[model samples]
Target: MNKLSIIIIFIVCLILFIVLSLSYTKLGTFDTVISSYIQHFRTRPGIYFFQCMTYVGSIRMYVPVICILSIYCAVRKKLLNICFLVFNLWGSRYLNQVLKLWYQRPRPDIHTLTTATGYSFPSGHAMNAAAFLGFIAYLIITEHQLRLWQKTILLVFTTLMILSISISRVYLGVHYPTDIIAGSAAGIAWLLLCILFHQRFIQ
Candidate 1:
């Protein structure tokens, strides 16, 4: 891993550790308020909107798009860039699942707005959204020589996409605010780890 990426990963991990510790100790009120706010956003219209956005954010269905991008990079002989993209995408998903099992927190059962099954502490939707869009943003900034304005636009759009997907999980009554927060942290950490791996071994 590059020194910068390693530093970023370390910082993210430290923050996550602190956040998780605080959540179970002194942040009870904070967690409750955030969870309530997320639950309040689970109105019918908002739920529908977020659910639709979640479908749009589905990485499984989007793999073809990633494949297309990867192929374009390969044709241009940017093999290392392709590897980074593919590895981040797959590795992030794997890490998300692993953390979900590790956390093993149950989903909210209060409102009965939507039926969801599985552990919910770390929202998979949020993690996947962050990983997918965050990697796209990284690729745009690193691999593609886009103009500054183009990079800004891409970053804004990807950020919105990730936020929308995260909101959807809460609106669907499947994940708590803390779940999404942890998922986002985990996603970022996974991306950083992938970058580190590439810098250390692949580069």
Candidate 2:
């Protein structure tokens, strides 16, 4: 998509996040019902599956990938790409922390299949997945060497990763559905802004 379209999506995501934040208090029923519904499908195997998937969005998992990508960029003499990659990933993380602190929303009172700390209005996993993986998808799409079918496969895989990580939070009973929604929205907005900046100035 063009930069103009990216800007429009960014604005829409920002608006959606703001609206969700403002209406959080009114979402108690929605959150409870959805949480219960997801939890109902929880089995030992399912929990184990999500536990593994959730780690895909974790710092420990992404850091090595980021380092590898950064080194690749450096070897290719694409310093700007390294900067963009680091900024997009780390920036999304910092934003997630600030929003969690601002909201201070507690984790779900339900029995959690996994351990988590800190506030949970917006899930860190969801946000990081959306921003980091989403940016990677953008990079893949823009790569001229990749065939159209190759790009499609990579994008579909990236999208599945993002969605899996987001849903893992809810299934594990560590986040509300709205938390995933808002986090994804905020992360996507930030991702689009970064892309727009690169297209307009860095490209």
State each model's C-alpha RMSD to the native: 2.9, 1.1
Error at 95, model 2, angstroms: 0.8
Candidate 2 Cα errors over 4 Å, as ranges: none
Q: For each of the candidates, give the backbone clash count.
A: 2, 0
Candidate 2 lDDT (Cα, 0 to 1): 0.89
| lDDT digits (tens) for residues 1-203 of candidate 2 | 97678878988999999999999889999999988998899888999999999988899999999999888878888788778889999999999999999999999876788889999978899998999999877875764588878988998899899999999999998999999999999999989988887777664
Task: Please give the lDDT score for candidate 1.
Answer: 0.74
Give lDDT per model, in order: 0.74, 0.89
Candidate 1 residue-wise lDDT at 65: 73
Q: What are the per-residue Cα lDDT tens digits for candidate 1 across 1-203?
A: 35875787769765984477357435557666876777775666877787788787677566887899889988989788787788787877777777768767777777556667778767777777777678777766766689989988998999988898887776666777777777887777776666666667644
Best by lDDT: 2
